[model samples]
Target: MGTKFTFYEFFAGAGMARAGLSDGWECLFANDSDELKQLSYADNWAGEDVDPRDVALVKASDLDGMADMGWASFPCQDLSQAGPKLGMGKAGSDALTRSGALWPFLDIIRDLATEGRHPILLALENVVGLLSSNGGADFHAICSTLSDIGYRFGAIVADASYFVPQSRPRVFIVALRREVPVPGALRGEFPVNPWHSKILLRARASLPDTDAANWVWWDPGAPPAKRLKELHDLLDLSDDADWNSDEQTERFVGMMTNSHLARLAEAQTAGRPMIGSLYFRMRPDSNGKNVQRAEIAFGETLGCLRTPKGGASRPRIITVDGDRVRTRLVTMREAASLMGLEENFNLPPTYHEAFKLIGDGVVPAVVRFLAERLLEPLASHGRAYAEAAAIQKASA
Candidate 1:
């Protein structure tokens, strides 16, 4: 075994996973299709290892080396709540077509298998919606398929709130090649811990019993996270900064329903200073009319940042302190901080592009937490794989 663990990253947008893992691990290769993200990634990494192309077009032969781990933060749009519910394997369905982007990743693994080159560990990240997508059938198929390919899968649902001020919950899957077993007996249900959320519990219950046998429900032996800074801490702009104009603020306020305005007024009237974050959601009103309602969270963590496809994508900040009320769009730096990116991390000059990069990327601190816990088990069996590979080469 070498002194350091290494990994290859797919869907490596803005290198957020890399930012998390960079401290303790080496990134051997990376791939992403978005050119703007590639620009941001290049600004930070500046290496030849980044392959800026669609994953489907990258041939197996292109992956010419081996690493200790493989990380894929696959696209979640096809499997998320806001997207169509077409299951992963449905024929001629757009959902299947889009989610099938995972096939190239599987193909790379298969290629490594053909060459007797297998990484001891693999990590997959996606939205929590994946667990219930297509009536939990898609999640089932993913576990079954990985098992078929000689991997034992373990999954946990983690939220970025533990590491940052955003409430982004995501499903993380860690897979080990069948040859390597974790220290303890693999169980389908682990004793509940601080990491156990209702969403995770429901997702666990939905897995097929047969597949559960191969499932390692890992318990991160850590206490619940302590509360960090509040939503107000994420606001980096000065009071005199150029933000929403008075007319624009009035226009946005007019777009909200009476109930939302009432909530804002109540918060503004509160004796204690309160900070609120706003995001628009399409919800049904009392008369069964689907209206765009502006939702606000006061003096709490901001909502999850998302790609700016619609009104829900951009989160607005509202601060009310001692009869003073202010509102403005969240800056790129603030979004980066919410994702646990470093202060010196490079960001695109363009606001929309930077926001998209931050929105689409994973929380580095969350990735680092998983990486630290996973390294020991992964390293313990590393020698065995090396020996097996050497023996096969000698025989050949």
Candidate 2:
């Protein structure tokens, strides 16, 4: 490869994000704490630089070499919508250190800066809940820290539904180290663009105006996504495998609310084939009763895949064919497809492992699209600087 841009994947879970950077760039280093994930990464990726250690314990010397970009999809459990809403607000305490795993990544970045080899671009991915956690204070604190370290930050709220069949809305932060004047005041009207949602707007408003100097609104012109009539469009031949038992199917239906049951009945009685994906959540129903309700999506879109921690955490497929409602847990391969992974990607050994690996990942297609746009300007600038320096040396 000729001068390929390289990146370090911090929190590189099973090399999924690295899979996204396969086309134009290469991974210089990868790190994650979980050994199971590390085994998956090693099995799938041939990179020898894979480091399986807690990020907090990783030293700056370990990442001494320079790279063009750094990708961090840090743990969002503490800040996720489904998990504890402990935002990254703690300063120096253990709770802060634990809940805000972003701190260790920040410390490493600071070390890189000290080494005078900081990556030109730093991209972070996390759940959208990061913006609202601690009333938007967590995100602002991150912005402030990035600004302090001489990097200008830009962010966008992107949804995997735009690229894949799953609705995974994540906040992506792209920070660049460049000199620029203070960003102008926020416009009176913040447009509800695809890249900026209401939550993003509120998060931006929380930051001090001074921090805006390095803040940019990143918008890559996204083409309209193709509409899906059914979830089968994204399914593979291997996804046809069913693992649900009779008792399991009954339990799943029993969890559905009356309204959902009626809808299923109506769809079945319509005398046509109706295919949908189901997700269970223990929440309130229309009758103000707390119960496990089966939420079905009729279109190509499916709900976000989460780690299979509980019965509700796993996604199930509901197919209504000629008055028969057949249900089965979505196959692991189907979960991989939903994550936009390549067909030939090596999956983990067990079903739960495979599902977990894909579920807690940045969709590969989305990452490739975003990373390409984010690197364009930086690449051009680097090339221009190198050419100028060459011309000066030649003249001398």
Candidate 3:
């Protein structure tokens, strides 16, 4: 064998990183706390041995002898807008304090470094809110800490829309050891910034001229990448999964109608022209719970997928036709399709688990994008390290 690169995945929920990295790297260890997710992961990677233990409860000392690369898609409950904004504090003290799981990640890195078993590469994923949390103080702290630990960090905000139909945007950080010289010349050109020109102009008007650096100017002339997939294109309607109960469907429709009416009344009260009716549907689970709901927007694309939290739930949808008819909720297969999982990717035995996994899992296409553009370039360095070790042993 030439060389084998090893991977240790932390917070490896349902093996999103595993799905993306397994083909490119050998996974030596994986961990997660959810039993359902663990079962799903085991089912997905049938032959791979993964231990479904709680990482927060596991000692870093136990990981002293395994893996060469570490990949963590830690729980973003503390960093996500969906959760509390506890930027690196203990969970449960407050809603904001609940979102700070970044510390656990750092703790693992610190332990690995202390034992001189620092992985060659470290990759982390989280919500974009992490960048501006605590007025960017949290981001600074994270970068500074990693630098102190002898790692050079680079980050990018990649949108799933680039490869999948959904508009899920996430922040990814890749940290490499300081001893490794980054191939700066091979760094891809920065993606063109895309924002509504009117929004940018309005934002600049609010800022002082001295603070021009804070304003982002959109390049209207730049040719953007093609908008590749659509919400409908990813659905596998043939699958008999993800149906809601009649009661749940009625409740969802009622909620959507009420929300739509509220918006319509608000527009009328503001003297704005009333748009057509917002069509929506209820996506049911096997147990008849309304796991997901979809609403059609006036003309814009489908709103981002989010966890359904009762009030004003789910992303908004736009209606294509002029008639203002209501629509049904998105199907389970559609959700899976939108997430870019393979057509037959492990279907949870229950609707609730299915929605949870889809909501929590990383989009496969986004993972593939990282693998090709970011991770593959570092492969040669890993191979070189392995080869050097082999030569040293042979000479000895």
Report how far off residue 44 is in candidate 2 (Å): 1.0
The Cα error of candidate 2 at residue 109, in Å, is 1.1
lDDT minimum window of 10 residues, candidate 3: 214-223
True-vs-predicted CA distance for residue 265, candidate 2, Å: 3.9
**Tens-digit per-residue lDDT, 209-312, candidate 1:** 87776777776667345745555566665767657776776666776777778877898778877767877788887899998766677756777888777545
TM-score of each predicted structure versus truth: 0.87, 0.87, 0.71
The pairs that clash in candidate 1 are: none
What C-alpha lDDT, on a 0 to 100 scale, does residue 306 get in candidate 3?
61
Our tally of clashes for model 2 stands at 1
Candidate 1, residue 183: how far the Cα is off, in Å? 1.5
Segments of candidate 2 deviating more than 4 angstroms: 47-49, 89-91, 97-99, 180-192, 227-230, 236-240, 243-251, 269-272, 284-290, 382-396
Q: lDDT tens digits, residues 6-105, model 2?
A: 7889989888788887757878778988887888888888645468788888877887577778889988887888887777756544656344877888
